[model samples]
Target chain A: MKSRKSLGDSEELKEINISPLIDMVFILLIFFIVTTVFVEEPGVEVQKPKAASIKDLEKNSILIAITAKGEIVFGGGQIGIGGIRPTVRRLCAQEKLPVILQVDESAPGALVVRAIDEAKLGKARAVFISANPI
Target chain B: MAIKRNFASSEDMTEINISPLIDMVFILLIFFIVTTVFVEEDGMEVSRPEPSAVQTMEKDSINFELRGTQVLMNGKNIGLGAVRAQVSRLIQGQDLPVIITVGEEASAGLLVRVIDESRLAGAKNVSLAGS
Candidate 1:
């Protein structure tokens, strides 16, 4: 019985404690999960123009995309410039969010201006053009 | 009998101490939660010219035209590299309104670049002419 007690003591000393490691892993996992922001694509991809004055946009704003072919896309559907005003009005009425326009580099200037005009008619608080930082 | 009972109870209390480990984990978790910055996608801010807005041609106003791929200042075709210099020289010591007139067929990218260059040159009131 004395020999068995010594042997058990030695085995206990050799055992590694993994509770701290498990706690560390759990902390890391929760950190990533809390900080991760899910970015939603606008369904249509366009080459964003580069600019020097780009600023971080608000996350909860409405997104309007203009394709290289001058197609206006909103909420995963192709919409006309006329449709922008009403949609923006409704969305802004619900939540006063800024409007962001993601215009393709090759899109016509007139279309972008028209979209801006419609967004203004909708009484958007602010308008932004999406561009990559130079 | 009392000594044997005390030894058996001491052996039973062999579990690892984890209170400090849990405290460290909680501190780390709180640090991460506090330091995390939830930054969203970014964009360049542009404001629409107000309708019924007065069109006042200030003495120090500079006109930048975006036609095709060329950037024109006062009707002279200047490269994009020279825009800042030209705008800075024209503004002198006065706050100038830089008006950008974009052609219908001109790419929006060109317009944005010209606006950025003008802003870089310290033009305070930059406005896009309604097409």
Candidate 2:
């Protein structure tokens, strides 16, 4: 092997620095984490009844909308009424996500109640009605 | 020159110390895991009660939204006057909480009867939609 230069006396070797690389990685990770917005999945396509005092819903719960035409839409799909309970049950068993009920002004009352019953069957602790700002 | 030197050393020595990277990755994964979600879709729908020319509800009373004179609690349909009992059950110890919802566009009287039932059920808090 070739004789190595005198490491210190010749001033040829440099310090092994990983601080800058670590710093750069940290910045990128932070940016990715910060800019990411977590949007909750709305389980149904129910038309929400409008209210004067309703506020823009905070996006941390599953939104379940029931349309006036009796379409049970979820995650943007139309599910029939009989399919609701088991679906909610399976979903809650998998992940106990919050449920928000968005009912249109023209929807059937009993149907709206049925949705809430399903939400209860799913073991959801709270079911919020989606209301609009007046 | 300094940046180039750092890059050069990193490229020359191929093996990366992945232990810390793995640890960090797992931590982030755990965080997202706890925060992940599944959605539930139910079939219930409600047409908001419409506005009518009626008396403004009392300032301190609980409101109930009943359909066809039937009551509801947490989405389950209950019998007539059942809403008041349910409201009392929810707000038993506290004063009546203000319950506000629109009146059915067709029937102002039905909404009033529901309001009356709320009072009978001991609504320390109740309110009607509009006058």
Candidate 3:
């Protein structure tokens, strides 16, 4: 009888209380959810020009990249100047996010201008050109 | 409450299965951790002139024409280094609109640098035009 009672005691001790673990996990999950901003990133990188008159832009805005070869990229795919208006319009319809143009230093000015004009036609709240601050 | 029934079922009813809940929470945590971007971009707003909003050029407005890699004012080449000094001197104490007419083949980098210099020189309204 004593051996059986000891076995029961060991079993009870083996059931480690996991409520605290669950509570910790819950806190972490909440933290991540609260701090997440679901902005679609442009996958390609470009050599941005350095400028003294730059400021921090909104974190939740649309990002479009212009490569040195004059390719307009949005969310890892190459899009033409004609694509800007529809893409920006579709995104802005869900939420009014500003459009950010990350242009390579050597990119063509005409393409950049067309992209900006298309973004405006898409009803972007504002348009910005990304540059590295000196 | 039935005391006899509760006593018989005490061991089995005390613990609830939470492995699935934990699995779900872990998945959510991993997804968010992966998607988070820590780099906040620094940029400048570009207000391009629209055809409908074209107003008559001011008498004191400054005109800059960017062709290829050269910056020309009234067909005279002013090197990039001279942009700031010349603009500051030209603006003096008045707010003059600076208009940059960019050729289709001009480099975006040079245009941006010129715009930055013009702004630094205290031009209140810097606008772009296409040639």
Winning candidate number (TM-score): 3
Across residues A45-133, which tens digit of lDDT does each residue of candidate 1 receive?
A: 88989988778898767788999899999878988888999989988896677889998999988788788888978989888899898
Each prediction's DockQ against the real complex: 0.36, 0.06, 0.61
lDDT scores for all predictions?
A: 0.79, 0.54, 0.87
**Model 3 agreement with the true structure over B5-122: per-residue lDDT tens digits:** 8878886786667899899998998888888777689988887764543565545578888989999987899978888888899999797778888888888899889999998998
TM-score of each: 0.70, 0.44, 0.82
What lDDT does candidate 1 reach at residue A64?
Answer: 89
Off by over 4 Å in 3: A1-23, B1-19, B50-53
**Pairs that clash in candidate 3:** none
After superposing candidate 1, which stretches have Cα over 4 Å from the reference? A1-41, B1-39, B51-54, B58-60
Question: Deviation in angstroms for B56 in model 3?
Answer: 2.9
Alpha-carbon RMSD of each model:
7.9, 13.7, 5.2
Best by DockQ: 3
How good is model 3 by TM-score? 0.82
Among these predictions, the greatest lDDT belongs to 3
Which segments of model 2 are wrong by more than 4 Å? A1-47, A52-58, B1-131
